[model samples]
Target: MGNAIGMVEFTSIARGIETSDYMIKAANVELLKSSTVCPGKYIVLIGGTTGDVKVSMSVGEKYGGEYLVDTLMIPNIHSQLIPAICLTNQVENPGAVGVLEFYSIASAITAGDVAAKAANITLIEIKIGYSIGGKGVVVLTGDVGAVLTAVEAAKKQCELLLQTTVIPKPSPKLYETLL
Candidate 1:
């Protein structure tokens, strides 16, 4: 079994709804407790195994502008960080180096699923977080080779099916030829 970590955020309510819908219906995910970190905003936490978790979120009616400015308040006594830090603190066995960070939560879930199915690796845990670009980020720690191979598979899958990139040209540049 292995673990995964990642996070993503969306700016627009429409986009967030789309993403959250994808996760709930297309991915058939279970919802964890919602967070009250952001005022008027809801942060839902959810996870399971490969089949259970499908990384997704929605932009609520409230916007998260500058909300992240608030410093995180993690209680010191036997908190969640302690366990995570302790677990990763140990040295990995041969062929079991923990997977680092993945580009997106979707990709990470896909990678973990692919690894479990194709490589017979188990996804012991998963962590999701918000990315700097407001996109989802996932971090997975599991079998070294399995994680790496899964990353490749997930990347390929993303390239083939998930990713949507847009390139924009300057308005003046486009109008120059017309003028």
Candidate 2:
């Protein structure tokens, strides 16, 4: 079997690790909180591969409604993190390394549910929607192809509702530009 990619979003990166892990966790929390607490703004986006992760936030509301809550925050975090959890059969073995980008949690989860059902993939969990255009994450594993396909599908499905430009997870091809 190959690795799998899981996507997630959070209102604020409040999921704290241990004290020693505070450095990285702090940056995530700060980044997530700054974006989500904007009262009303674009969402955050995140995507991750087996050993890699990405993080980003949306510009503003281009999806639906004027303002959105951060309901999917915690659940996205759980869902994205759950795969690695189950894979290792441990709550926090190597932990889940993921990338977050600016995508609709509602869109991602809704599409994810459909994808999971159709593909026989298990859903780790789900949560309500909040903090529109705030924060999102994608976790990838297994075969790079499968993970890439899943990411494309999720974004394509979400584009129907969301109208903002999405920055794809940086790959080697884009590493130079990203740098």
Candidate 3:
């Protein structure tokens, strides 16, 4: 058993829904999220052991077919990733905060994982494209140097409109808002 994660994005909701169903049935992976996102796109997230996740993703990709937009598979996903994606992370004493924004949920998730693995930071949140016009947002907290390093590492993975900011000694209200 391992913490592996995978995702598939689709332009057609019908195909996405069908693909998600097939994905779960094809493997022992747990369905994380499967629903329509912003701008009329559909996204499905799944997690399990590395082998199971890989199998599920393969089925999802095959069934996704023409409607597939993008896909991601992380063999060893970070511990904070699921919480961040599900908005269940709790904040602690923070020194600096970093924000990374992307045009796609898959990009944001990929970058978020990179950032988390690159530095000793706490991923505050990884808001997917449920709202905010299909944009993905990642929030993290750590020392100024770590936050900066994490943000920079994450920036390299994005292929679209990306906005990033690092706030040193962020206001408490900012953390509150993020949580």
Candidate 4:
């Protein structure tokens, strides 16, 4: 099976933590993030082979029960997606930048993968509702044309999209502030 990533968001931190433990123990997958986000919601992210990710996701969802807020699973996900999610992407001297805002972390992550696959762009960040009122944010950088094209593609695939923008020539300080 191809590589994949999964996420489960919960309204209750206790359930989220329990589910994360089950998810990792259920399959040979890597636990990427397991923590509380803005608005007191918790999220668990994992990655592995497609089949393993699927198995682990099922365990998480089953354990998540009534506390589940949202879920995401991407098979053969874009290489940049994980780094962006972890806020470790290093994009320097960006020619242009694009931003996608969504109401859920899942939507933002899905759109980030879509945008990365659609154009020659580097995903700058995938801020998962941290200090942002439970809204997701995706940022990518590339040439003006690529950034525009990628943003359009991401927007088309995104659900609960709040806003989107492409800055052709962003200020140097703008890039620094994103981190």
Candidate 5:
């Protein structure tokens, strides 16, 4: 994992694969994730130094061409973002949760990174693509002020914000179901 993260989403899986290959070959970036998203889209996530990530995204965008759906390069992504997106960590009984919903996985990921870096919040989950019909959602928790600040940061990064909510305190059952 690195402070910088780059991602590209493509409308065509074939183009996405091709772009990813070019991107990896062109830069010293590590490929974090590359998979088919819901609604037949494809996404590639890479991590490295800011310069490397930027170089990779440039190559990706060039190869993506007309198939490109979205792209992002975060120079100082939050430390907790990748883990939450990968679903490899858990936070028990988080407080004052906030949710940000977007129309695309790439958008959600970009916004989530911004949110996480903006406040001292814990990223609970980043659900995207599959089973959600191409939509994406970011869930985070902290004190009410932190959650609100994070959500606002995310909103600034997101173009198609479908929904956003802040729950100061959720019921036990709701926490059980969501977390």
Candidate 6:
């Protein structure tokens, strides 16, 4: 993982775009993800050294104003987080499975990081926006104990957890569908 990952979610596309541009110009951070999510929201994800990410996020927050819905600056994030967010982490056979849903992308990412660090688990996916009405979802699979621990850790990060579940023994069909 990079030294840090920073994200800013905005309710206004115009403000989000402008703020993202300012962020990139203000620091030496690499733009990871930048696009409009569901419900007309805009999200900007960047990565770099901790100092650079903090500077970029500060610039973004200054420019975001009221349009900013959420901001996240996670230094030394879990190694699996970025890949899961990008939907590139693959699990051939899932064991116990856990899912966490949140109202904000920033919160979801934070929860995922905490969960991953709390237990030995595989992050299956971290889906944001799309058909889920601008919400965020994180999926993980591991031993029953690990899954339970991961879910517990994730729950602590969100004010209102939209949904959280742990399937102790998922059916093969379920794995086929989710993975």
Best by TM-score: 4
Candidate 4 per-residue lDDT, tens place, 64-172, comes to 9999999999998988999998888888657798999999999999999999999999999999989999999999999998999999998888899999988888887
- List runs of model 4 lying over 4 Å from the truth: none
Q: All candidates' TM-scores?
A: 0.35, 0.30, 0.95, 0.96, 0.90, 0.95
**Which stretches of model 3 miss by more than 4 angstroms?**
none
Model 5 C-alpha lDDT per residue in residues 1-179, reported as the tens digit of each score: 45899889899999898888999999899998888988999999999999989999999988899999888777888788888788764786489989999997878888888888899888988987878988989999889999999999889867889999999998878778777
TM-score order of candidates, top first? 4, 3, 6, 5, 1, 2
Off by over 4 Å in 2: 1-100, 114-133, 160-179
Compared with the true structure, the alpha-carbon lDDT of candidate 2 equals: 0.32
lDDT of 1 by residue, 46-161 (tens): 43344334232222212334332211111111222222322232223223323424434344344444544444333433333332332222233345565566555645654223
Task: In model 6, state the lDDT of residue 125.
Answer: 91
All models: lDDT? 0.35, 0.32, 0.89, 0.91, 0.87, 0.90
User: Top model by lDDT, which number?
Assistant: 4
Please give the RMSD to the true structure for each candidate, in Å.
15.9, 13.6, 1.2, 1.4, 1.8, 1.3
lDDT by residue for model 2 over 1-179, one digit each (tens)?
11222223233233211111332232232222222323243334233332322211121112222333332322223243334323322222111122224445545444443334333223322222344333333333223344445445655655333332223343545433222
Backbone-clash count (model 4): 0
Model 6 clashing-pair count: 0
Clashing pairs in 5: none
TM-score of predicted structure 3: 0.95
Pairs of residues clashing in candidate 4: none
24-135, model 3: which lDDT tens digit per residue?
Answer: 9999989999999999999999999999999999999999998999999888888899999998877776779999989888889988899999999999989888778888
- Ranking, lDDT, top scorer first: 4, 6, 3, 5, 1, 2
Cα deviation at 121, candidate 4, in Å, is 0.5
Worst 10 residues of 4 by lDDT: 170-179
